[model samples]
Target: MAIEIENKDQQHPRAKKDGEVVERLLQESANDNNLAEVARLRIRYGGFPGARSMQRNLDIVLERWNLTEEGLFELTRQIHAEGRAYKRNSNGEEQEDWT
Candidate 1:
C-alpha cells in the first residue's frame, strides 16, 4: 500500500514582507561600492545556512573586489531570500517570475 502526504495550505504571513526586504536589499547592493565589507557583515550576522560555506564564498568574492559593511546586510539578505525562493518554488509553491 502507498501512503499519500498532504501539503499545508496556509500562507506564511511574512512572505510578502520578506520579499519586499529582499527587493530593497538588491537595489541597495547594486548601487553600493563597498562590497567587501558588506560581505564581511553578512558572514557575521546574516544567519545564513552553512556559515562556513557562506564565509568561504564571501572570501572568494572579496579577493577580486573592494567592499565594506555599508551595504553587506542588504546583499546577504538578498542571498538568503533567493535561497528561500528557490526552495519554495521547487516545492511546488507558486513560482516567482525572477525574469
Candidate 2:
C-alpha cells in the first residue's frame, strides 16, 4: 500500500520531514526487533485524526516493514503481561520501567 501525498504542494515542509523521521524510526525499530518501540510508535500515531499525512506515512511504514497493526498490538500486549513493558505517565512521558 503505497501512500503518496495527494497534494504535495499543500503539505508543510516540516510535516513532511517529520513523517520521514517517523518512517526512519519505525524501520530502525523493526530492524532491531524493538517491538516495544514499534508499539510505542503505533500508540503515538495510529488513528491520529489530527494529521492525515502522518497517518498515511504510518500505513506506509507498516506495509514496508511487513507488519500488521493487529499482530503488533498482540505482541505488545504479551510484552505488557510479562512485566517487561514501559508505561506512559499522565504527562505522556515514558517511565524508565513499569516498576
Candidate 3:
C-alpha cells in the first residue's frame, strides 16, 4: 500500500474517516488503469453528497501519475485521431469525448 513515509504513524490525519472509502474508489479506479474514470468520479461524487475527501488530490494524483489536463486532452485527441475513442453522433456532439 502507498503511504506517506513520514506519516507512518497516521499523525497527519489529513483525510476524514470516510476519506479512505473515497480514496479506495480512486485507488480501485486507478488499479484498473481507469485514470479517466478516476478523474471523472472525482468531479462527480467529489462535488456531490457522500464525498469525504476534498478534490484537491486529483491534481496530486495527476501530477504523481504524470496525468495533466493538457496531457489527457492530447491523449484524447490522439485516440480520436486513431479512431479508438471517437464516433460522430447524428448531432454535432461528440459520442465519447472524455475531455
Candidate 4:
C-alpha cells in the first residue's frame, strides 16, 4: 500500500500523516488549510530513499514539530552505495571529474 502522496515537485512522499493515528503540527506562518498537508509533506519528502524515521513515523512528527531534526540523518546514513549516492560536492552542484 502507498503512504503519503508526493507534492508537485514529486521529489518524495509526505510524512506527517501516518496510517491514521498520529496528528500533524505545521508552522503558523504560511500555514493554512495546506499547513497540515505541508507538515506532512516535509516529513514524508524529507526522509526519502529510506523508511520514515530512524525508528518509526512518530519520530518524524517530533522532528518537524520541534524543528529539531526529523529523519535528517537518514539522508546521510550512506543510504545508497557509491553508484546510488549523488556524486556532488557539499554545495550540491555536481562536481567535475579530473581523474
Best by lDDT: 2
The reply for model 3, stretches above 4 Å from the true place, is 1-22, 25-33, 42-52, 77-99
Q: What would you estimate as the lDDT of candidate 3?
A: 0.49
How displaced is residue 41 in candidate 3, in Å? 3.3
TM-score per model over all chains: 0.27, 0.49, 0.36, 0.21
Q: Write the per-residue lDDT of candidate 2 for residues 1-99, one digit (tens) a residue.
A: 998866333443345555666767655646323566556656765554456767676677677667898977787788867866666689987664211
> For model 3, how does the per-residue alpha-carbon lDDT over 64-95 read when each residue is reduced to its tens digit?
66677677555555554665553457895554
**Candidate 3: how many backbone clashes?**
0
lDDT of 1 by residue, 1-99 (tens): 999987544443443544444334444533333342334334443544333443444544443344444445556566655663223456678443322
lDDT tens digits, residue span 1-99, model 4: 879966542222322224332443322322222233333444454535543442244454445544334333333233333333335678887442211
Residue pairs with backbone atoms closer than 3 Å in model 3 (clashes): none
Candidate 2 lowest-lDDT run of ten: 7-16
Candidate scoring better on TM-score of 3 and 4: 3
| Candidates, ranked, lDDT | 2, 3, 1, 4
Predicted structure 3, TM vs. truth: 0.36
Candidate 1 lDDT (Cα, 0 to 1)? 0.43
**55, model 1: CA deviation in Å?**
19
> If ranked by TM-score, best first, what sequence of candidates would result?
2, 3, 1, 4
lDDT values, one for every candidate: 0.43, 0.62, 0.49, 0.38
